[model samples]
Target: STRMRFGRGAASPAGVLRAIASGGGTDAFRLDGVDHRDDAGRLEVLATEDLAVEQIGYADVVVLSRADACSPEALRRAEERVAVQNGAAAIASAARGEMRGPSTLEALLGLRRADFVQTTPAKATHHHAYESVSLTLDGEVDGERFADFVETEVARFSGRLLRTKGILAVAGLEQRMIVQGVADLVEITFGEPWGDAKRTSRVAIVGFGLDVGSLERAFTTCAAS
Candidate 1:
């Protein structure tokens, strides 16, 4: 049998660092609360947060909370900022601490084990100017078309697209499609069925200085015809 231990902390990296150095091997590092800070004092707070992220050296994932209170544009911008600072981390959005399902768990813990011995300390990058956007569709989308759209858009926005994810209703599929992208890497997987519940599409995009209206319109075009 394999043994695993997990640890968490608030506004501090010491505990997490100690956990990583204990030789148990870290499965992942998650930075929560990416959307809760205000712009007025965000610079100082973001600086502290970036330092903590760098100290940890690597984060496998980032979670954005209080997403419901923010506009899609705000969410997208936040994702972009996080991407710029932690380019390798996957970003997920949560509302009132609730994530989608097993997919979130898989994303948080499914990565290759951290090899601290060969890992180099990360250098801090300033991320004060990032922005994001979110979109919600009340209908099903053509799966093939959506896939093509995502691939093209991610490539086109490679430099600015920090993170993108969607829980979608595919026109011919019963199972929900969960789409996630970090920079140019895109992952699409089938999730649990919608069962008797209402089917809808929800997507959030995080990027740098994105044209929110234009992106929203483009996404809307991917709906089934």
Candidate 2:
């Protein structure tokens, strides 16, 4: 950037325009990127600062990444902030290598999430400093208690919790309960039937500085007792 006469730490205007331009096509999605950590809250895309706001303003989506890093209130504020600049664009939250809300990969790819079979994600080859906990249960869980746990205790640790996704075997529900959460925001939906598959409940939590024992204990307590 220095050699090109742009600010020392800032992106080149031509580069930003060229990159955003490359995303154009009838089938393409114009995404205005921001992070809930700072950029979203500030409603600023430093990389595109020098470029005309109109150049990047025409977007089909506003991607707010790292939403798990912020509180529910913070996320709400970030959305409002982003909307000030890109009010027409749909908002999407991304976390834990998967989209947490609408505008997911499948949606972008023109596919329905329910059309695919849910499977355990393959183990990653690399590891980061964050801690991950996986628990399995052969018995059914108490749906109400699990929902309360997600709304309360689990949400209380949002700052350090990156993601919590699981296949829940609810005591009376015949179909599997699929849950995915980031911070205090969680989405739960009924999935396909167990069929011939074993009735097992598996929950995985990924985060930084997580108290494994406490989380696991509290999690198990949601069992139908």
Candidate 3:
């Protein structure tokens, strides 16, 4: 596992990118409560400014620090917003830098090219240039139908869609399915069983100039009939 951290008062985006280029490893960004401020004064770990938002897009994993101080609603909103900015990035919430287990650290440090394939190397650019959308579906879905939907989506969206990943409940399968797509290439494989976890589908799509509503509706229709 490889890891690098950027302090709260680190250099600018250009400097960070330069460091990353030289460092030659996976990058993870930790956002804290002090960095985020909303209408309710300062919501710890729930709000972020331009710099943090931009970093989220470039990171392989994003950890929301000081989450214990934030309200449940605030944390939910923050997760939702972060999901839309970098759908492929693994997200987790921590309190005082303490996470559940080593798995969280592994998830943050693990760099899989197949999981997050970038169309273009990250550089200092406008934050709003790209967008990410996350979708959640309950119940099982038809495997073939889901595959067809992903194929069509990648074809239609083409280059604009940087990456897409999901944990799906495929009909007639005891184990969960992990789907990952980079541009036009997509892969689906079986993961662990549902076990005690809730059976649901969660997906994240990252790209530029996406019609999120249309994509969401199209994905919904792919559910098992």
The local lDDT score (0 to 100) that residue 131 gets in candidate 1 is 44
Candidate 3 lDDT at 122 equals: 25
C-alpha lDDT of candidate 1 relative to the true structure: 0.55
Find the 10 residues in a row with the least total lDDT in model 1: 112-121
**Backbone clashes, each candidate:** 12, 0, 1
lDDT of each: 0.55, 0.53, 0.59
The better-scoring model by lDDT among 1 and 3 is: 3
lDDT by residue (89-185, candidate 2, tens digit) is 3456666545765545546422211222223322222223344456666778998988787777677676565445577789888898876544334
lDDT leader: 3
TM-score of each: 0.50, 0.46, 0.57
TM-score of 1: 0.50
Ordered list by lDDT, greatest first: 3, 1, 2
Which lDDT value does model 3 have at 147? 75
In model 3, which range of ten residues has the least summed lDDT?
Answer: 32-41
Decide which is better by lDDT, 1 or 2.
Answer: 1
Candidate 1 per-residue lDDT over residues 14-128, each given as its tens digit: 3543444333555565332122222311323554554444422234455666777777787777665555554434556667667633255655543211110111212223543
The parts of candidate 1 lying over 4 Å away from their true place are: 1-127
Q: What is the Å distance of residue 160 in model 1 from its true position?
A: 1.9
